[model samples]
Target: MSKGNIGVTTENIFPIIKKFLYSDHEIFLRELVSNAVDASQKMKTLSSVGEFNGELGELKVSISIDEKAKTLTISDRGVGMTAEEIEKYINQIAFSGAEEFVDKYKDDANAIIGHFGLGFYSSFMVAKKVNIITQSHKDGAKAVKWTCDGSPEYTLEEVEKEDRGTDIVLHIDEENENFLQKAEITTLLNKYCKFLPVPVVFGNKTEWKDGKEEETAEENQINDVAPLWTRTPSELKDEDYNQFYKDLYPMSEDPIFNIHLNVDYPFNLTGVLYFPKIKNNVEVQKNKIQLYSNQVFITDSVENIVPEFLTLLHGVIDSPDIPLNVSRSYLQADGNVKKISNHITKKVADRLAEIFKADRADFEAKWDSLKLFIGYGMLTEEKFYDKAQKFSLFKNTDGKYFTFDEYKDIIKENQTDKDDQLVYLYTTNVEEQHSFIEAAKNKGYDVLVMDGQLDNHFVNHLEQKFEKSRFVRVDSDVAEKLIPKESTLESQLSAGDKDDLTSVFSAQVPNGDKMNFIVAFEAMGKDSSPAIITQQEFMRRMKEMSAMQGGGGMNFYGEMPDSYQLVVNENHPIVERILADKNEAVGKEADSLRSKIESLNGKRQELEKAKEGKKEEEIEQAQKDELADVDKKISELNTKKTEVLSKFSTDNKLVSQLIDLALLSNNMLKGEALTKFVKRSIDLI
Candidate 1:
């Protein structure tokens, strides 16, 4: 027996490893089992290449938990270390035995998981003491036992051991005695070693017999050795891929489609990414994409490895190119990761394009479920957006689907506005905005159903992508004004009548939470609705994006009240009648006030014109005084005119009914307001 200090830089290495090496202490099982797999694969490689002349026994990894003795042992039949090898590999710090073995057998070895020498020290995270009982497969090599407590000191001695393998025995600490349970050990094994190349047995298999589970003699191998992604795509059927997806997410709905990725040029990557039926809320379905390296599970939070939008996809992405730190808990920002992300984005776009080209009917059939994912990708990644536009579908209000180009071609002739800008009219809710949608359809304009939670941001993105194109909600403006092909009819209302209509409708607008209504007059033909509720596309989009992205100077818009435009069709019969009634109510009073206002404005204009081209001292004080007096008189007359209009508007039930009707059509009228509107509507009828 011999004792020596570990060849490490610091005496506190064990504490650092236990406290800071791994973010999750449970990852110790993954590290140890991965190392065991590496060793088993290396042995097979050496034997095949004639480096070792011996009978290749069954190479299996076993984990045994002894609760009474408080011991958890992991035994692997592999290239175990002899006394000399243990002295060199075990004592040395930061020097990985697997790395040296891989370098020697680089041509023939399977994928080696461990490059850092810290995997063995992970045992100290959950154990008070650890022992390694190992025997070399070399001829005349002595079996060695290495023991280390939770300190720098360790003992290595020659021991009379059994088979040519390694057994790592961890004396479970009182704080981590959960490792001594069969269920806990089984779970760890299943998570980390389920896809390992070698078989990993946790304990004896169980059979349901005599109305209870009984232990059987068969070994309970917890690993599949070859997951679906590890096999070639040609060998896999739809059922195989689906079964694998079910295995990954037991309770998730069937995926809309899948993309099998196999790339080896710049970086080695092989995995299956499934497009799950994502809900409208993108954030809720994130972190479902798991990342792996050479069949060992790394993390589900693959936000860094995949593009931000691809995180919504559910599946596995394994790449040896993804750089991991010592613990393999988090990924470092590497160019390779970015390359992989861009590659994945390309692959996903290509798969969608293929689907769209091969069977567009089928693709459109699944568009409702696939839209969120594709829209998210387009909104987030620039390259993805470029590729996704090819296959992206734009569904019209009539339940018809068209690709971006196809839809553009279909509407480019009619939907182009007076400015030659293509107007894409969309509605967020079909049922709620049914009137607006029908109104657009009546004008022979197509209205897209942009109802997804990300549609607001998506449309904003499309505006930038589509050349000279604008996306306006169907209810964002009146139907004729939405795609204005010709000069609209001038409002027949005089300035005073327009003012009266504005004051009347604006006064009756609902005073709901964070709602502001602006009254405007448009000559949208007599057949149009008397009043229509609409929101400004740009400001509404800013507020919507601000709410989604949640900060970065956009909070100002988000905090502001929702502003809506209450458009009164001046040519409509009801609006004309409302204006007539309002004029009748305030006609006499409005005339007297307008005459006085015009006299004051005429006097003030002459005085302002006299001072326009003069120097400050050249202007007379009497002229300034006169101008001030005239401005005060004009302001007073205007106030009196507003008072007459307000009085007439407040007394008119039709004004309130029109405003409520607009709100009801837009799904804004609710509760007491809706009830009041119904009562008023019946009374008017």
Candidate 2:
């Protein structure tokens, strides 16, 4: 027997290990179990290379809990350390046995998990004392028992006869007594050791016998030794992938498609990424991708490991290149991690292109659910955008799908404007914008459905990527102007006539505080609606994006009132009749006021032009007084003219009906205004 204090620079290392070595105290189980797995794998490697000539029977890692004794033991059938090996590896705090074994057997070792010697010290986190009983595979080697409390001191001595391997017995501390519970240990094993290369046995498998649970002869193996990600893609069937998905997430819906990643040259990376049917909310879908290192589950929040948008995917990513001690800053700075992320982005984009090329109809069928992911990627990752453009699709309001180039080809002839810009018409709500969509379709122009959660941002991205192109919502302008192929129609109404018409229509618009109506005349032909409402494309997009982004710098647009163009088609018969009726009712009064206002405005303009080059003091006082009087008289006449128009508009129910019809079409007429419109509509009928 021999006794000694652990070799260290300081005596405070154990306290740091107990308090801050790992973020979660439960991580101790993962570290210990992983060590056991490494030992079992080393034994297999030695036998495979003929280093060990003994019977290599049933290599497994077994975990057991003694509740009354308040102890848990993890045993393995693998390479065990001799007494001298224990003094060097265990007593020297930071010395790692697995690291040495891996360096020596780099070619044949099966997934050695421990790179940091600190994994063994993690046991001190939950245990008051730990004992190791190990027997090396070398012939005539004496078995040894090593004991250590939660300190630097330890004891090593010869032990009773036993099979070659190791047994790590942890005496649970009073504060962490929960580690001795069967259910608690079972859950920890399932989470951390569920996919270890060696089979992990917890206890005897149980079955119902005579309506009661009873232990069976078979041992309960908790892990799948060979997970789907570890195997070659050629060996897997669709059913096998699906079953693995179910095993990973029992309650989640089936995935739309999957990408199997396997690469070895620059850095080894292998895993399966599944494109799940993401919900409308991008936030709830994140943290679903589990990250692993050599089949050992590391974390679920892989935001640092993958690009931000790829967090929407679900499944597993295992890479030995990614270290177990993952800090956000480390992952961000690591060169290998960046390569892995870039590789994943390329793999996803290539897989999508392949699927689209293999079966376009099937791809189209799944586009509705797939666009959110693709759109998010395109908006956030430039590399992904470059690759995704080949497979990305545009869905029309007619339930038809087309690639970006294909849609451009279809619309180039008919939808290109006089400025040589291809206009991509789109609608957010099919039912609400039905009229606008129909108007566009009637003119042989196709409209896309840009209604996804990220469509607003994605449209902006596409504009930057697609040269000489723009996306215009169907309702952003009148059908005739949406994709202008010729010069705009000239309105025949005089400036004075337009002013009178503006007052008539603007007087009936609802909720001046929340909505602003800009009355304008457009010659949209006699077949068009007499009055149509449209919003400007730029302002509308800014406001939509502001709302989506929760209103940052673009909040200025969101805070402004909604401005709509109450476009009255000058060629429509109803508008012609309304103009005629307004002239008949208020023409005499309006004409007299306009003549007085025009004469006064001429005198005022002459005075303003005369004083243009002169300083304010140089201008004569009498001239200023006279100019002020002319402006006041002109303002009075304009007020009187506005009153006459207002009275005419109030008396004419046709004007109200036209304005309400425009509002109703835009889905903006709601609450009390909608109620009043319903009543007035019946009265007019």
Pick the TM-score winner.
2
Local accuracy of candidate 2 as per-residue lDDT tens digits, 1-685: 9988999888998898899888888888888888889988998999999999889999999899888888899998888889988888888876888889999999998898887777888889899999999999888889999999977788889988569889999999999998888889889888888999999999999999999999999999999999999999999999998999999889988999899999997999999999998877899989888888888888898988899999999999988888545121134458888888899998899999999999999999999889999999999999998888888999998899888889999999999898999999999999999999999999999999999999988888889888999999999889998987675567767888888888888777664777787888888877889999999999888988889878999999999988889888887888878889989999878888888888898888899999998999999999999998998898888888888898899889899888888888888888998898899888888
Worst lDDT run of 10 residues, candidate 1, spans 503-512
Pairs with steric clashes in candidate 2? none
lDDT of each: 0.87, 0.88
Give the per-residue lDDT digits (tens) of candidate 1, residues 227-274: 888899999899998999999899988888788999998999999999
Question: Candidate 1: which pairs clash?
Answer: none
| Model 2 CA lDDT for position 621 | 99
**Per-model TM values vs. the true structure:** 0.94, 0.95
